[model samples]
Target: MDKLRRVLSGQEENEERGLTSQVLDASSLSYSTRVKWFFICFVAGILLSILGTALLFIPGGGFKLFAVFYTLGNLAALGSTCFLMGPLKQLKRMFEPTRLIATIVMLLCFVLTLCAVFWWDKKPLAILFCVLQFLAMTWYSISYIPFARDAVMKCFTTCLS
Candidate 1:
């Protein structure tokens, strides 16, 4: 944090700093870079979800469970993005992470896929293979890196008083 103190207190000039430095404090981050990772993940999720919609158009065929699950997951995510997240309130951690409203939809998708394979109709070997694809998609969707990056950056601090 001494680097930040240096930058903030003007103990060292901004021209002497490098972009590659890890300690940015609050002022050194550019607006675009600050939010870029979230935007990329958001766009990628949308595109993967559109492919799920296209699967619905196939005739008498495959991926019904997959398409339905993906649709529900995306819609729930979109709703949470709209309603759940607000200006990062550290004091209100207890009011968040409500599964039925936010995270349970994705969990439901995973459980239902496995249940469908077992109880609905385990017809042929070919059917199992197609169902396997759905399971893969659900697993991939569920396995996500929730945070973009480390929340804080720290570097050399030997020089500060």
Candidate 2:
């Protein structure tokens, strides 16, 4: 009840953590804090995606497991992408108009794929949607990988140590 009220009121307090976190109001976040969250979320997305992909390749994994992991992976990737796009948009030369359009298209595909997963009754349509989603994901990966490689490498190194 307290948490719900805080969220609705646009102010939050994390008593267990000894923290009082404000809601993401327009004036709340600093530039560095936003950037920190972006990197953190991106790293998490990469880890989830890798784990999910590994599950897909297990020899005896059932369709249900595959779908679960795939959905989780894609959802994470989509979230990270959303975070990154904000900063990426600020780069005038690096992110051209066409690139922004492509990013928007990829976001759309991710959403459609998520919806298709819920429509399991229409197997044919689901398969087609999945295929299209895969293509869009693949295309986005080409651009996203370069940006994420450093973060992923650092995350792995930190985890190993």
Candidate 3:
């Protein structure tokens, strides 16, 4: 009960601490502040993603621009969640057994998309990787909602049958 009150009031525990703990406490934003920043980052991420998609219509180097912006947007959106759950906790949750594969695949696709666009200069490959990234990100995201993954799988199976 006391801990919950502290959390709700955005106060840290008055426990014995070390330098690292002190630093983290000093840098930690209040709950409301964290939520505000999270919203800002998430909205910017969505806007960037929309702009990137619109850029797909432009000729010559458009795909490259789209890939970069899209990847950055996804990264920003992912990072925004860290504000709600601190970065360490977010990382731990991301690597948990239930979502581990989805997380890894999503990150890998992000890297591959940029590599295909900038290094390989292969528009088709970049597009393919971007599609994969979208799918992976969707899977990873639904993991956070209870039974969402199961529902998605059931829907796909029913469609196939």
Candidate 4:
């Protein structure tokens, strides 16, 4: 309870692991670095997700493997979005609102996935939700590409200099 309280209040510290604060501050990293990491994570997530889809085409009992890849990809994408939020929020003026929308879309996808998996009849709705989720993810990724591109250029220039 105490630990939770401290973490919630943003006062937690773990010195042994060399962690200074429990709270994450986006300003701690350079904008370009943040963008680069975001890009890497996003690409990884997309690749994993595509691989998961490919697994779905397998003829026999690939559900488990498909689930594994799908879950991993989703988690990666979600994690990347969250990780970039701090830096993007600080560096970009338009990120906050769009982030909110993306979050909501993901949440809806979650609910729909659960409903579709358990209820059987709602599978169509789940399919629709999946499409919506894909669009949201695509939009979120595309919107942030500029920041990552700028960061790459900055890094390239600095290396040349």
Candidate 5:
């Protein structure tokens, strides 16, 4: 009722809005617009990741290119979620107890992957970090679905047994 009235009146309630909320609201991005951007960013991220994989076949500098593109792609895909849940909320959720370790590992992998490729000049180390990044990202993503991690653990144990 109050929400409907506020919407119809073209006025925001007198509640205190944070800077992030105010900026998002000022941009006038409708829900549909946010969804559209999210998909666009997500698809672009996937394409970049695929391109990086393809570049791995190329000789000289292939590893470097792959590391850079793959890292950027992961970052883009991770950031796309911010459109659905505003940045602050997305960040808060990311660091929640359930996902803290996964998020930290994924972020650390991103940094180490870049460092291994650029500064350390270690292709194998960069590739290893990228693999870890993928696994951490997968774990982090599954954390969002109820019982997903438990199910995965069960499956792994079953396979081992």
Candidate 6:
């Protein structure tokens, strides 16, 4: 992060600080606050995806509810990742509106999975959907690791014991 800071400080380029690292470092909630929730939601999403896919195999599984759930959740994940593309810096944030939004998206996805899980047919499609859903889950967890590391470093340097 200091490297990023130094880099942004124009130590490398001899210019102004870049917005990329700053935004990444400035997430609304601290890394600690988000870590548990991110992992929990990501894991839950993966599980729901698998269950939904499995449900498709159950012969009556491709219900509108489940389809909506799986599709919408996956799309939401795609949108969530967009947040990663923002600049990285210390935001000195107060409330986390993004988290609330994420929660709503995740909840909707969860309900959709329930619809899929209750199905009685369509195993192959179910598995496919689950695999894709899991991919999104994995991405959310994996991509955030680097950002989390930066946040941790920020806390270490800025916090007093």
Displacement of residue 152 (Cα, Å) in model 6 is: 30
Give each model a TM-score.
0.35, 0.44, 0.87, 0.50, 0.86, 0.33
Candidate 5 lDDT, 29-113, residue by residue in tens:
6899999999999998899899999998999978889999999999999999998887878999999999999999999999999
lDDT of 6 by residue, 59-155 (tens): 5534544565555555444443333332121111111353334334444444444444456344445445455545444433433355764675578
Candidate number with the higher TM-score (1 or 6) = 1
lDDT by residue (tens digit), candidate 3, 61-93: 688789999998899988999999989899999
Over 24-70, each residue of candidate 4 has an lDDT whose tens digit, in order, gives 43136676786788788878987887887787678764443444566
Give per-model CA RMSD. Answer: 17.3, 12.7, 5.7, 11.9, 4.0, 16.1
Compared with the true structure, what per-residue lDDT tens digits does model 2 show for residues 1-161? 56789989989866544233333233355667766777777677667656655665677633334455555666566565445445334344234653565556655665555565565544355456556656666655555456664676578799999
| Candidate 5 residue 45 C-alpha distance from true site, Å | 0.8
Candidate no. 5 TM-score: 0.86
* lDDT, model 5, position 140: 97
Each candidate: what lDDT? 0.45, 0.57, 0.90, 0.63, 0.92, 0.48
Off-target runs (Cα >4 Å) in candidate 6 are 1-27, 61-66, 72-161
Q: lDDT of model 3 at residue 146? A: 99
Clashes (backbone N, CA, C under 3 Å), per candidate, total 0, 0, 0, 0, 0, 26
3 or 5, greater by lDDT: 5
Name the runs in model 3 displaced over 4 angstroms.
1-17
lDDT (Cα) of model 1: 0.45
